[model samples]
Target: MQLSVLDQSVAVTGRTEDASIRETLTLARHCEALGYRRFWVSEHHSHPTIVGSAPEVLMAAIAATTSRIRVGSAGVMLPHYAALKVAEQFRVLEAIAPGRIDLGVGRAPGSDMRTARLLSSDPRQSADNFPIQVRELQAWLAGVDLPEGHPGRGVTANPMGPSAPEMWMLGSSDYGAQLAAHYGLPYAFAYFITDGQGAGQALDLYRANYRPSPRHPAPQAVLCVWALAADTEAEAWHHFSGRERWKIDRNRGALAALPSPEEVALRPYTPAEQMEADKLRANAFVGSGPQVAAKLRALANTLEVEELVVITWAHDPAARRRSYELLAREFF
Candidate 1:
């Protein structure tokens, strides 16, 4: 099916529980043992909900622990940082993990407008420059000579850096699709971010306008989705019940610890919250091995996605770990 499973690092925790960095490292190492194709750490600045704000730092830890699995950002919100610096850091990571590193960049600053403005002071950078940054980073990794007027010409990256980690354009919108087409790198669509809109139009735009380059002749696509599997459908849904409630509360300016499955079930919820929860879970695939496999397969055909990255959030860390293990056993 040309399908590969993927997971996001959320630092799984209970309502009042804390997930230690040590525990996260262990979880990631366990995934490597479980044989996932790639483990992607998302980038978010100063979020109490997630522990992976610095993807490179976490990559260093993960790279040290595993040998076969590819590790990189599901996206490292590129607009927030310098391309050369990102290139250098990933080059170092590539030095350690070699062919196993992947770089997926997103245009979003990953926060509210106020916070985005604080992080990305320049108002001029929109989706237009994302392609340029990806190209610039690729050149930096390839050791291609920079343009004479380019400010980064003076800086040098690692001599031992592996062939630049495979680059990917990530987005939930058409702008990212166009950028991916222009650059000819693999493109990933976050179905989780799209809120149930059909990505077909955007994917069509990407394939139609795709320009072939030596680096990538065929366009590659990944559908990023929220998924979970346990011994039973009820257990899987219950396992994810806390994160589900957490998401329901996140919009109300509440970032409190996630409630446990039992607590969320017992707790009262507004009608509005219930509606949103239904929509979120509508995209979420939670069930047993056979059921999850069937849902994922159908999603793959419906999206025509070359790869499937299962980005999950579960209430319990152990349950989250088991989810990966289950996927590995069924699909890997």
Candidate 2:
């Protein structure tokens, strides 16, 4: 199975955004050397823990820093910007690294409603126009004309060449699966965020209804999940404690930098919080290299996906890197 990474450039309790970005670049290079297929960064706006607000800029930086690994967004929230602009930005990236660039688009806001309004021209629109946006983006990227009488019919996203960046639709629901199937694009399921709920159904729907397009002739699906590995099961649990605490805090509407294991150990938690954490933990894979490897392989086999994109968070940058290193050694 192929393995990839989806890094949020998470800011730890004691680290600055600059430090977080540096760690992202370092991790990209490390994963590339370790033979990862792709290294994708996330986009979040006004989030205390996440530092990746602009995936296009970060993708360019990662592409310049790494030689072999494909770099892209995990993805860019499409509703926030014009499709033509998004296409242009990624086209420039394609020029920078050609086939190494990917344009993963999603419909979510990637932030709270308040921040969403700030980014979007009309935040109150109840009906989602993401299907229309995707069509425009695809047209611009392919340098093809939109349907006659369309507002974007005459517009062209410049820098178009013989090849465009690969596009993948990212979603956690059946709606996204159906949309991707209709468009004949590759689909990536956010299993970590959805806690593995409805994933089987979503993938099944995508495969059953998928139409062949020039970009993706066959159904290609990727599963993204939270994972961590350590030398021992106990140490891996220690790394996961912070993630558990972070999830609890996030559910309570309290966002903060990723706490350290020591900090998590010292915090007092209610029974409900503990239950929530346990539930989240059940969806995550944390153990020794072989243990995590076995679980990941089983999951991939069950999902029938050839690629797995892992998202790991820890207070220590070294620990995060080590986790990927161990997993790569075990699987790759």
Candidate 3:
């Protein structure tokens, strides 16, 4: 199995949010050294917990700093921006790193409707035109002629080079799967987003309906999963305490930065909250390196995917790095 990374530049308590961005860059370089396949960042706008609002900018930085690992967005929210502009931005990135860019696009608004409206040229613009946008974005990225009667028939996204960014359709639902299948693009299911719900169905739909393209003759699928690993199972669970508390609090409308595990240990959970926490813990991939790696292998095999993009969060950036290091030791 090929293990990749999806770093969201998570903000931790008592640290500046900008620090999270820097940490993401540092982690990308670290992952590259550890022999990971790709280092993908996420796009989330006006989000308190997730600060990676600009994935294209961050991808450029990562592409400049890392020589081998593939760099991409997981992904750029298509409805928020013009396809031509996104194509141009990624074209510039391809110019920077050549064959290492992956342009993952999605239909969902990465933020609240107010922020989505602010991001759009038309405040009323919804995701209804996502398919059209993806078609145009793909054409522009590859410097192909737009179809007849298209508004961008003659325009080209320039600095067109020897290579173009590989496109991947990303989602937590079947909509992205079907769209990706229709376009013959790679599909990545956000297993971490829905905590594995609907993942099997989405992947099955993608493979069953896939239309072969020149770039991809066969269906390609990826799972973006959340996992953490440490020296021991107990230690791993301790490190996961912060994310667990954050998840529960997030459900209760508290979007605070990740608290330290030490701080989490002191808080008391109600019976219902404790049950919820237990459910999350049971579902989580937290343990020693071998234990977590075993689960990762099982999940990849069960999902019938060769690539698993691991995304980990911890109050301490060191712990996050260690998590990746441990997994790399097992898988790489």
Candidate 4:
């Protein structure tokens, strides 16, 4: 099995953005030493808790910091930028680190509508043209000519290299899965966000409708999930509590920085909030080292996926790093 990481550079309640980003670099090195295959950063906009608004820039930093781990985006939101620009940016990355970059693209805005407008001139129009944009991006990356009379037929993304970055389509729903299958691209399902529901159906649909292309001759799938591990089950839950509260805040449209475990423990929760938290907890794999390994194995078996991209959310950097350390020791 191949294990990878998806880091959002989440801000701790009392830490600076710089501290969060520094920890990201440190975690990249840590995961690389632990034998992780890939290190992917996420893209978010106007989110107080998330500092990873520009995944390509952060990916470059991670690539510069670590030598072995493949660095890429969990996804760059395709609706916010020109397809040629996206291809050019990733081409430059591939030039710097050949055969070690992945370009994961998504159709969603990655933010609220207001922020989407800030990032894109015509947010709705851009989203409506997602499929067309994806085709153009593929053409640019492959250095092939678009169809006759296409807008980008003659234009080329300069500095096209010998190889293009491996491309993957990221999605939380079956729409994305079908689209990815149509393009013959690898698909990554956001099991963490969907709480593991409907994943089987989506993956099944992807495989059933997949068509072979030069970029991906066979169907490939990856499950991106939330996970945490520690020496004891109690310690693991202690770290997970903060993330639970953060999820509740997100549900309530309150995007606060991640609270400390100690802070979460002292708060009084109503029955409704507690119920919501319980539901949110279902999405995470949190336990002692052995228990987490067993659960992950079971999930992989059930989903029929060989690759896992783990996202660990914790208030303290040490706890987050420890979680990965324990999991790596258990799994690798």
Clashes of each: 1, 0, 0, 0
lDDT ranking from best candidate downward = 3, 2, 4, 1
How would you encode candidate 2's per-residue C-alpha lDDT over 1-332 as one tens digit per residue?
99999999998887677899989999999999999999999999999999799999989999987788999898999988888899999999998888899899998889987888898776554228889899889889988899999998888898977789999999999998999999999999999988899999999999999999987899999999999999999999999999889989888889999999999989888999878877776767999999999999999999999999999999988899999999999877
Alpha-carbon local distance difference test for all models? 0.76, 0.91, 0.94, 0.90
Per residue, candidate 1 scores C-alpha lDDT tens digits across 200-254 of: 8778889999998777898888888778889788899888788888887777787
Best by TM-score: 3
Q: Scored by Cα lDDT, where does model 4 land?
A: 0.90
Clashing pairs in 2: none
Question: Which pairs clash (backbone N, Cα, C closer than 3 Å) in model 3?
Answer: none
Give the TM-score of each candidate.
0.90, 0.96, 0.99, 0.97
Cα error, candidate 1, residue 256 (Å): 3.2
- RMSD of candidate 1 to the truth, in angstroms, is 2.6
lDDT of 2: 0.91
lDDT tens digits, residues 1-332, model 3? 99999999998889999999999999999999999999999999899999999999999999998899999999999999889999999999999999999999998888888888888887656799999999999899988999899889999998899999999999899899999999999999999999999999999999999999999999999999999999889989999999999999999998988899989979989998999999999899999999999999999989899999999999988889999999999987
